[model samples]
Target: MDFLTLLQLLDTTVRLATPLLLACLAGLYSERAGIFDIGLEGKMLAAAFFSAAFAYSTGSVWLGLLAGIGVSLVLSGIHGLASITFRGNQLISGLAITMLAGGMTVLIAQDWFKQGGRTPQLEGAARFEPITLPFAETLREVPFIGPLYYELISGHPILVYIAFALVPLTWWILFRTRFGLRLRAVGENPASVDTAGVSVVALRYSAVMICGVLCGLAGAYLATALQAGFVKDMTAGRGYIALAALIFAKWRPWYALWATLLFGLFQALELRPDLIQQVIGVKVQVQLLGALPYILTVVILAGFVGKAIPPRAGGEPYVKER
Candidate 1:
């Protein structure tokens, strides 16, 4: 491929990677705090629907984002209540949340918009547009750096930059802060955390809430930024892919970024089958390419790639007297 083509590929990869990166980080935070959240997909779906609905109604993308985050947090709170407060099975609780979101988004959409589970098409301030970076126009003729800067590095919505910047921030928070230490400790050994005079429930709740916020942003990006509005199940299993990415990254922030990008590259290739065939000089099945993320997930989970050890207390409810 030529340098320009390569830059185009990189640009596509970044766009596709944004939501996966956000959802992967969401799962990382929840799982690292001993909460196995299979409901990331659900939260994103719910947020996407609500964000789109609100944005279309109010003509403000910012309000839509806030609405998405609020809905996601409510669902996260439900999960926290069921798992932490009631000490129920975390997996089942997560599954319930996902199912609930799946059903409610479609139901509400059909009732409100009468478009068979799609919100009204968004326009103007309701949708996010790309922000051109400084020097992009000035450097458009500067050899290899020109296209790289203007084409690849510029012209994404602000959320894309925020998603990328979050990697280092998440890394720092999980490794460099006292809350990070306690959060990790709670996931590993809740009893030990309790003995140290910390509230295990509180930390786990906080982690799950953070997960909700990130998933909310991921949904908003999809509904308002990536597309004009929400459709039925627009998330389309990104949450599961993100979960797989979390496992693939072994719950590390930097690795999560790389893993999501790899998956995004696979998706980008799927979108451009001609490019893949050109690179390989062989006919490639689009179906197989589309299945790449799930295939990788199964491989990683089966330990064919490598052992991915989860947190010790993951998927278990903490009991103070146990």
Candidate 2:
């Protein structure tokens, strides 16, 4: 491939990976706090739909983004209440939340937009514009690597930066701050955290709510930044993939970022039908290529390197005494 072609591929890879990175990091917040969040996909889908709808109505992308995050946070709050406060089964609660969010998003979109569960097209200003790098443009006139930096790193949406930036912040939160220590302690043993005068339930609720906010931003990125507008179920199991990435990364934010990028590369390949045929030298059906990443997920989980060990108290609710 040519230099420009490689640069384009890198750009596309980052674009495709942003949603997964965002969602995986979002899931990481909850899971690291010993909460299993299987409903990330639903949250993303709901937020995407709501974001597009709000943006279309108000003609303000920022307002739409806030609306999306707000809706998903409320939905996630329900899950937190059911699983953490009520001590419900985390898996069942997450699944139910996903189903509810997905169904409600579709139903609301269909009823209101009348586009059969799809939103209207978005305007240019309603979408995220690519940001050009300061020195890369000037340096592109130098040589080959300069062109590489210019094309590959420059002109990406603001969300892409946020998605990558989140990795370090997530790591800092998990390993640095006082709340991070308490969160980790809660995941390790809620009783211990409670004994130490921390509110375990409150911490878990906060973690889950943050997960909702990240998932909401992820959904909005899919609609407004990744694509022009919302379509019915456009998230298309990306949330599950993000979950897989979270586990694959062993609950680490930077590792999850890399894992998400790998899957996103597969997604980018699937989008380019010819690339698969050329690279693999087989007339692989589009459906099969589309299935490759999920297949990989199953294989990775099924002892390719041994069983993945989750946090000991993950998915268990804590009831603290006053």
Pick by lDDT: which candidate is best?
1
Tens-place lDDT per residue, model 2, 1-322, is 5567667777798999999999999998898889999999989998898888898888888888998899889889988988898999988988998889778987999999898888899887787778888987789887887878788778888988998999999899899999998887888788998888778888999999999999999999999888988898899999998998887887888889898988887777777778656666877777876777677667767868656667778988776657
TM-score of 1: 0.98
Query: What local lDDT score does residue 68 receive in model 1, on the 0 to 100 scale?
Result: 97
Query: How does each model score on TM-score?
Result: 0.98, 0.94
Error of 1 at 264 (Å): 0.5
Structure candidate 1, residue pairs in collision: none
lDDT of 1 at 288: 91
Off by over 4 Å in 2: 276-288, 320-322
Query: Would you give me the overall lDDT of model 1?
Result: 0.94
For model 2 the local lDDT of residue 79 reads 86
Residues 1-322 of candidate 1 have per-residue lDDT tens digits of 8888888888999998999999999999999999999999999999999999999999999999999999999999999999899999989998999999999999999999999999999999998889999999999999989889999999999999999999999999999999999999999999999999999989999999999999999999999998999999999999998998899999999999999999999888888889877888998898897788888878887898787899999999998894
Task: Give the Å shift of residue 199 in candidate 1.
Answer: 0.5
